[model samples]
Target: MKPSEEKPAIIALPKARRHTYYFLNYADEFKSVYLDTEIDMSEVKRRRDKLKLSGHRISYIVFLIEAISRVIRLYPEANSSVKHGMIPQMAVYHRIAAKFTLDKTMDGRRFVMSGIIPDSDQMPLEGMQKMIEYYRDTEADEITEFANVRKLQSMPLWLGRWIYRLAMGNLSRRAKLQGTFTITSLGHRPIQAFYPIISNTLCFGVGAIEDKPVVMAGQIAIRPMMKLSLAFDHRAIDGALAADILTEVKKVLEFASESDEASTQGEEVTPVGAST
Candidate 1:
């Protein structure tokens, strides 16, 4: 057969993924600064194992969210987003809201969506995990947010673009709709490091955890390590502040112990949307 005659088949883009194009197009408005660091997950693994043995299992993403949320609370500048105009303005949030994406299957096709955990700094580890589990396990059609995403996908491309921009134009609503920052992970695969785009001021990229050689006490030893990458809009955040936040998150993750878990469990705070 002639090479020209043996062409590969092509498929149309699914409506479910239509929003990603809008998101990427919108992300182009910001100039993002990227950084990556390796985190030693040895202690965190040990703590998680202990918790799991006690029937209080916590997911790695939830744990990282809790830690990073606290760090975000410490750095006010880190919890802000920029609104561009004739002169740009920064919208600082009083609460730390963590946004994480989920891969959902709808109508036999897979699509990605996100969920927000408001006041994440105040939420306990178990509570955050519960919300994440809900997002992961629930049917996409059943959840109001995911349902809205479907509606957007079903709209014409121009209409969807207008609606998305309208919703994202207001910083306050954008924070509530999205979050102060975003966390995306490819940890299920063997990928070690990658950079992500930013909608808000910051976006965190998480890579898989694997055994790697590291120096400890002046000796090389194998340790369970994960790659954490941060992408920040330089217009809203400077490199110094971003580095500080990344370092703080790394410290919170690497030095985490059973005591840290105990402290969070002892905090008297309601879950994200619990009635008062």
Candidate 2:
């Protein structure tokens, strides 16, 4: 028999299906929320002072972790994973994985930090503060160390794709591991904001805080505003649920401010007629 006649015709899957198969496994659903608040660095500094008296550093990461923990508690479904064409599965680990940029050299790389929040429910605000300080102080060396360990790791684009497929397929089943959510503060970059990408996991973007006028207690006040975007796989979480989670996060941040105010008021008072 002729070779052409003996060989069966090769059929190709639809473009969408193939694309889905290729990217969906790694694709994470992401959303962002833009928060405009009258809060500024000065306010944060003042609040930190109060928190410091209470033995805490009210850093940015601390605020983020606290807010994210609340969000996760309110909308546990957001902490889910998309695996093997099955329904999005919820993860028990209330942790968040974030990417930290290491270097800007020719091969500028990023490292992923998993389990930032140890125990969401039980994590004291001070613990979150310390974690942020640790990361800020050591992220440089840590990323370098991690990169060195992975220095020998290299794969062709096509091969990497295949590996991703296998990992997202059967291998993921064996581990059955996923975080509650993924948070990226890429907005830390000066000009970048408003990323509308989706991932297999829920994602939130923390953007640069800009100056804007906002109403606080019926008074127009200038506030440092930041964008918060939360993207989730629509398949895993519905719009209402996502909104609920974001809303809860907002409440936490606002509450933090109120808490700071109350703490500041509780400090030693200066009597009206007392001399210095």
Candidate 3:
């Protein structure tokens, strides 16, 4: 083999990864807002156990997707993307699109996959679960992010960086290519704290759920709780907006079991549990 063949070859990168590669590198003014909140899992665990007993199953990620989607519906600003600039003029998305992370092992190292769920606000829980499971199992050619990433890795790093910067310079294309927000779940890991890399206006991570003691009804109780961390672009999002979105998201998760029914019947249930 030739000496050069033994080293890495130059690659031609596709649009999405190149854009991501550049934005992450060049956007030094981008701000991140980190938050920690917990969700009560009493209802979710019950529903999950019941489904499993009946040979039906749904992952918590389904509920997670719905919760965030609903929050963005009421607060579209949370889903806005940068139109352009080191300082960006924001473009709002009327519909919510979620970007999720997945992993596959290759040669004993991690090969990351991107999962995009569009219109999660309207997708039923069952459908969301099925879609996630399908993507997790297959390396489908249609997964544009992963497909582009594979190509990006084949190129020399320095070449890839410049190509990324050039490709991402187009504001019109960038907003459409990248998801409005990102979600990463740490359920499979034992981690209790989750902080994510923010490329959009906002990104959040679902930390592990575990049983813990809490005071409820003025008495001690043990409950299952999960920690959530959210990071926001301070340039585009203010503290007030971020706080309200967090409040909205917390409400959706704690009462996730009743939210759909309540929306349909137009009657709100008395909220239970705490998140702080």
* TM-score per candidate, chains pooled: 0.90, 0.61, 0.79
lDDT of 3 by residue, 224-269 (tens): 9898888888877898788777777787677655436312122332
User: Which portions of model 2 miss their true places by more than 4 Å?
Assistant: 1-25, 28-46, 52-56, 84-116, 129-152, 170-178, 196-200, 257-276
Please write out the lDDT profile of model 2 over residues 68-160, one tens digit for every residue.
Answer: 655565455556654434453443334443322212212244434322444544456666555555655664435443342232234444554
List clashing residue pairs in candidate 3: 11-155, 33-232
Using lDDT as the yardstick, the better of models 1 and 2 is 1
Cα lDDT computed for each candidate against the true fold: 0.84, 0.49, 0.70
Expressed as tens digits, the lDDT of each residue in 140-227 for candidate 1 is: 8888777777888889888988898888878888899889989999999999997988898889999999998999999999999999
lDDT, candidate 1, equals: 0.84
Q: Using TM-score as the measure, which candidate wins? A: 1
RMSD of 3: 5.9
Off by over 4 Å in 3: 1-29, 53-55, 83-87, 140-145, 257-276
The deviation in Å at residue 214 for candidate 3 is 0.6
